[model samples]
Target: MEKNKISVTSDNIFPIIKKFLYSDQEVFLRELVSNATDAVLKLKTIVELGNFDDFIDDFKIKIIIDKKNKSIHIIDNGIGMTKEEIKKYINQIAFSGAEEFIKKYKTSNIIGHFGLGFYSSFIVSNQVQIFTKSYKKNASSIFWSCDGSTNFIIKEIEKKNRGTKIVLFLNEESKEFLEYNRILKLLQKYCKFMPITISLSSIEDKEKETIINNINPAWKINPLQLSDKNYLNFYHELYSHQLDDPLFWIHLNIDHPFNLTGILFFPKIEKRIDIQKERIHLYQNQVYITDNLEGIVADFLSLLRGVIDSPDIPLNVSRSHLQSDPSVKNISKYITRKVADKLDSMFRNHRKDFQNKWENIKIIVEYGMISTENFFVKAIKFFIFSTVNNVYFTLDEFKEKIKETQKNKEGKIVFLYSSDKEKQYSYIKEAKDRNYEILILNSPISVHLIQKLEFSYKEICFVRVDSDHIDKLINHKKEDKCYSELSETEKKNLKNIISSNLMENYKFSIKLENLSKKDYPFLIIVPEFLRRIKEMNSIGKEFFEKDKEKYYQLIVNTNHIFMKKILKETCEKKREKMIQEVLNLTLLSQNLLHGKNLTLFISEKLENLTKK
Candidate 1:
């Protein structure tokens, strides 16, 4: 046995590595397994160059848990080092700094760009032993051991096998990793897509060995070779817990500028459904890196779930945290462009299917369009405008269909929409009767998106269906002489009587219209400006929330027979009661009446019926 101090610039490197270089104890296993993969890949390269004559078969990495002895072993059938090679590679630590090594092989697919990866063993173990045999001729087997300090032992051993075996005597703090389920989860997370076959014994079948990883995933293969079914199967395989299938997926591959490969799936997320916020798993050469890829993935893309493998996104020595660099921004922009292209293709080729899925997926797409300027610029053309009638249209199609009728005399194309169809049924019906199409924009971000459209879409404006009278919404046609107009004094008296009964918090204004007698006697209208401000307040806009109190327009139709009866009644009490009942019913239709008010209205309706 030959023992010596490790050749390093600092003697305290081991303590620093355990304390600073690595923080997550679970990464020790990842580092060991990745090193084994690197060793096999190195030998494979020699064979490809025709320098090595041996026919290599059965490449695999195995993880063994010896619970009784408090040790975990990572065994690999890969190229191993002899005595002299061990001294040069292991003893001379930090010879090639992790930063220098990674910069040299930044473009390569090799996982261990950092020489310090092997030292991560100190994170969870107090002592580690390595038994290895080199494949070279005249190479004797060797044993190397270190006790989480500067002192280490290297000795010649009589070994028959040609590979490396690492045994970690776990520290008391890291004994939790000995749990079968915990180790199994780490293996699934980090090594599920690694190139090498990982062998492990399962909890259910303790006697049998199982392959935990899929060596070849669909993202690495050509998109043309994969069918929709193939992609779907992969999706469910990656996310076994998810019950709903993805609406579609985009296979992203790029070699130039920067290396990036991924598959992003858009699940069926509707406005009514709570945003599950599927995280995008970011990887480096099939090794799991992180899912919190905020800087690398646009905020809006967090709704999409998938795997992104890119050697360009650099990580620190521990491979724990991602580095925020220019490459990250470049990759993010590329992904955004790729998603835009995919959506554009679907809209142009499979328009009907795109429309069918629009209502389910539009919230995310709209979010992307609103948050990302580049996405908006590229995807605006393919956006589908959905109507209350369940019909869909592209931005241009809807614009053309309504350009002649929906545009005001000021040349602003109006997009009339409703938040709740049930609550605003009377308003929507009135708009639809005049042959005007009402778009349904009811998502949480609808108000903000409408504000964004006002700026993005030149000479275009969006108004809620209940914002104003139908005649004012589309002023293209002349109003019909449906009923005689009421004088100013009569309108003033009508406003005063309504205000006396309604609560002060609800400020009501009176508007006179010559609508048909069959139309609603009174329609409650919330101005688009105030309603939009209220919407913003509900979603973290505290400045707008302070004044989000609601005020409404109570439009009285002069042509309605009941309005004439109330106006002509001689008994003040009877007239006031009739007016109050009509106002209460209007409020009820708008969902504005609550508890006591709603109960009183119901009681009044029953009493009037009994009197009749």
Candidate 2:
């Protein structure tokens, strides 16, 4: 028999396997069992190639826990290694035996790529023994043993079948692996969808029976083969306690460019805004790698729950590849394109269903559009905007429907929006009075999206509800005459009275218009562009902050009855107390009165009402 030494000189290999091979200790079970499953698949490939003439039965992988023996065994009817192969593979730890084997049998469609997957046994086992018999005629069976140290033992052994069995002597810290229920739970998590059958030992009526894993998961099969009902049934299998059914599903399968297969489900989200990011699972050859897929998948796709298996995703030494790479970028772009195409197709074929899912799924689409420019251009056609009256319209459709009424002074299309309906109810009603539509821009991303839209589309602008009066929303070119009943002296006195009573941080400006007495007692008008910029800055928008001065215009109407009466009284008696009271009342109505002035105004009003 040939002999070989492990490649690395470091006696710290066991510690490396236990601590550095994977991020989570539980993943060791997945790595080891996945290795076994891959071995069975290679044996099946050899059988199909007709090189190994032995009669290979239906292959299966099995896990056996011996609680009394303090050991766990994983058995597989796969390609058993000969003595020479064992010396080259099992003896040489850190040497990628699987990579060399696949290179030798390059045309066999082998799945295992790295040999170190087996050394993961050291993560939970103090001692590991491997017994194997090759399919070659007259081949001798061999037993290999290692005790988590540099030393090992190998010799001939007795075995009936052409396969391999791994016996792991559980360490004191890893006694949990010997529990039947724990091993079963792990098998379900990591091996449920493996191509080969997997069995776990279970006792019924004190009789031990091997329970097999379900090999053909729904994702591996053709989606066309399964009816919609069958797909829904599989979704229930994945998440039963989840109350609502999925709004939609994406069956991802591709073989030519790179091996990838998955079934991603968009479950009915309760609050689309609070989308969780830990749902998508990344897998390599059916072995789950990690659920934190933020780097591998686009942020928007985090709303989806499912598995993404691909052999092409190159992992670092630790198996947890959080950093960005070319393959990950390609996958993310592909997913974003697929999602956009799926939504676009649904829009064309099934309008009603798309609408039904819009409220929940829109978050995904919106986030993607905002993040990816290409996705934005594609989805802008299907994105729906809702008005205050709960009417939905596509961007193009809405622009078309309101072109007659929403265009402004510069002939630009002005979209009026409000964040708080109750606070801006009067402004919204006034806009509606002039046959203008108000958009509900309640989302935190609205300002950013509006900015992007303004840059993307020419002659389009967004104005807040309280930005300006209704007459100024869509400009009328018919110039009106301006007449002030107050002389220049009266106007000067009125301005002084208004400025003296205004809040310290605020500036009060007076503008006279010949508006009818049917108008408000006093109207405050903030310029459209300035108000939007200020609103944007309040939300931490840097572009608005950079050019901050253009963010507001507080216009008070002097033509109103209250302002007229105040001006007349100020001229008649110069009664400073009455003028201050009236000016403070006007400031309070505009939500501007504050601090000492506000406190004094409230106290004086209370005293006057009490005396009356």
Candidate 3:
């Protein structure tokens, strides 16, 4: 037996590694298993290159848990280290054996680049032992052990297998690693799509081993060899808890500028505000790295779900998160372009099918258009607008269809939209009466998207259906001729009476208009600008929320019979009652009448009906 100190700059290396090496203590399993995978792949590559005649039929990794001993073993049948190789690779700190092997063989299959992954074992273990036998002929098996310090023991051991076994003796705080369910969950999370087969076995059930990884994941396979069913199956495998199948997916495979391969699925989003990010899992050579791909993926594209495996994606030393690199930006741009191309293809080739899935996928597409300029340029060809009547049209197509009639006096195209078809039913019906198409902009981010669209298409403006009356919404110059017949004094008196009865929390600007007799006597309209700012405040922008004053335009139709009767009535009490009833009706239509005001309105109506 030979004893030596680990060659490092500082004797405190072990404590630093144990305490601050990895973000999560559970990452020790990922690091150790990834090293095992690298070893197996190196041997496989060597065998495939005709460097070795001894071929192992079963190249598998087994994770053994011994609860009684509070130890876990990660064993792999791969290229193991002899005594000298162990000294060179294990004793030296930050000297990557995987890097050396890849340079020697010109192979890209090795996963480990940072030599420090092995030291992560110290994060959870008080002691670690390595029993390895080299595949070289006449090579002696080596035994190496370290006890959370610089001192290590190395000697020749009698072993029959040509592989490596890493045994970690758990520390007091890390006893949870010995539990069967705990280790199984870590394996499922980190090594679920490893290229080599991995199995888990506990001492309680040593006879039975459960396979924990998929040797051939969909992203690692050739795109041409996969069918739609295969893709769907893989999606279900990735997200087993999701009940609804994805509307569609983009198969991304590129090798030109940087290596990137993955499948991104567009899920059916029922609520845009509840959109779950971090669903896109990032991997480095099939080893799961992270799902929080903030810097590596565009913010809008995080709405997509799937796997992204790219050896070129630069990770920090711990491999826990991505580092800032130009390649990351390139990968993000490539993915955005790929998604845009896929959506364009779907829209062109399968119009009916794309239309069928548009409602479920519009949020993603709209968000992309709003956030990315290049994606917006490409998405405009496929990004569609759907009306309340279920008609779909591209932006250009819709512009052409409504160009003749929907233009305001300033010649800018007016796109009418209703956020709630039921709550704003009257406004939607009024627009439909004049042959104007009303779009359903009901998503939580619709306000933001509307601003983005207006900025993009400079000649167009989006107005909510309930934002104003149809005359003001479309802004036909001819409609301005209609005005109230009452004198200015009578109008002023009417405004004061109506304003005094309104809630103090809101401010109403009373306007008298000679609208159609068929229209309601009173119409409450929220100014478009104020309503948009308030809506934006509701969706997380608090800058505008400080105003606290709600504003509305109360348009009283002079041609309506109730208004004329109220103006001519001799009884002051009856006239006041009529005005109150009309104001209450308007407030109820806006869904703003509540508490005492709502109760009073209901009771007054009931009392009048009883008298009749």
Candidate 4:
């Protein structure tokens, strides 16, 4: 046996590693397991190269927890280290054996880029030991031990098996790592899709051995070999608790510019827009990295759930966060383009099926279109608009369909939409009466999406069905002539009567329009710009509390008999009562009549009916 100080420039290297090297101490297992995986892959590469003649039966990594001894053992049947290699790799800090091996064998399968992975064990363990035997002719086995310090002991030892066994003696602060459930969860989280088979067992329950990792995950396989069922099964495996299966998926297998392979699933998102981040699990060479891929994935695509593996994605030293790099931007753009292409293909090939799935996927699609300009440019070919009648049309199709009739005086095509199908049913009906298509833009982010669309297509404008009177919704430069012979003075008096009888708490501007008699005597119309701003503010909660009062325009139809009756009434009291009833009806239509006002309106209607 020989003892020597670790070859490092500083005596505080171990302290730096334990306290600041890794953000999460639980990642120690990931680092150690990744190192083991690299060893196995290196050995396999050597065998494939015909350098190693010995026939290897199996390649696996086993994690054994010995709670009685307060230690954990990670045993692997892979390329192990000899005494001289141990002295060079284990004693020297930050000198990577995996890097050197990769350069020598020209293999990209090695997972460890930094030699510091072995030292991560000290984050949870006070002392770590390794018993390794190299697969070489006339090779002597080696034993190495380090007690979280600069000093280490390495020597030649007798061993029959040609592999590596690492032992970690847990510290008191890391007692939680000793729990079988805790270690199992960490393994499942970090090593579930590793390239090699990884099994976990407790010495106390050796009979209950559990293989914790899949040797070959679906992402690593060729896309042609996977069926829809295979993809969905893999999706459920990734998110076992999710109730609904994915609507569709895009198999990314790019090797040209950068190595990237993974499956992205278009999950069934509802109308609520639950933008769940960290759903896109990022991986580096099949080793699990962080899931919060802020820089690696486009912000809108973060709403999607799946696995994205790429060795090209730059990561921090600890692999807990993404590092800023041009490669990350390229990867994000590539992913966006792939997703857009997939949707475009689906829309072109399966029109009816895509239409059927629109409601389930529109939120994500719309969000992507609104947030990513490149994605928006590609998505416009497939992004659809669905009418209240459940009819779907692409933006270009809808534009062509409405170009003849729905264009305003400025040549902007008007798009009529409703946020609430039930509450705005009357407005939708009025628009449909004039042969206007009323789209259902009820998603939580529809207001923002509409703004994006308007900015993108300057020749188009979106107006809610209830945003204005039916005729004014689309400016045709034509007006209905009033049938009433009431003079201007009489119109002013009618407005005054209604204004005096209106609820003091309500905020509105009175306007008399020469609308057809078929229109409501008193119609409440919210201006499109104000309503959209309010909706956007509601979504972002960026408005002042005092400025949240509902404001609208009260349009009185001059052709209606109610207006004439109110003006011609000989009794002032009866005229005021009629005006109040009309105001109540308009308020009820707008859903603003509530509490005492709604109760009073109901009581007065019941009393009038009883009198009749």
- Choose 2 or 3, whichever is better by TM-score: 3
Q: Order the candidates by TM-score, highest first — what do you get?
A: 4, 3, 1, 2
| TM-score for each of the candidates | 0.91, 0.83, 0.94, 0.95
lDDT of 2 by residue, 346-446 (tens): 98898877887877776677777788887898999888877888777888888898887778889999888887787677788878877788887776567
* Residue lDDT tens for model 3, 1-612: 999997656476757866887989999999999999998998999899898998578999999999889899999999999899898888887789999998999988789997999999999898999999998899999999999898999999899999999999999999988888988999999999999999999988888788998889999889899999999999989998887778888888988888899999989885574648439898888898888988777788888899999999999999987889998899989998888889899999999999998888888887888888999899989988889998998889988888878987788999999988989999999999988998888887888889988998999999999987897778665744466667788777766656765546356677777787788989988788888987877643464444323466888887677766876777877776777777777778868687898998889778989994
Which pairs clash in model 1? Answer: none
Alpha carbon RMSD to native, model 3? 3.9
CA shift of 145, model 3, Å: 1.4
Ranking by lDDT: 3, 4, 1, 2
Q: Highest TM-score, which number?
A: 4
Each candidate structure's count of clashing pairs: 0, 1, 0, 0
- Compose the digit string of candidate 1's lDDT tens values, residues 565-589: 8667878888877877777777777
Poorest stretch of ten by lDDT in candidate 4: 540-549
Displacement of the residue 459 alpha carbon in candidate 2, Å: 1.3
TM-score of 1: 0.91
The C-alpha RMSD in Å for every predicted model, in order, reads 4.5, 5.3, 3.9, 3.7
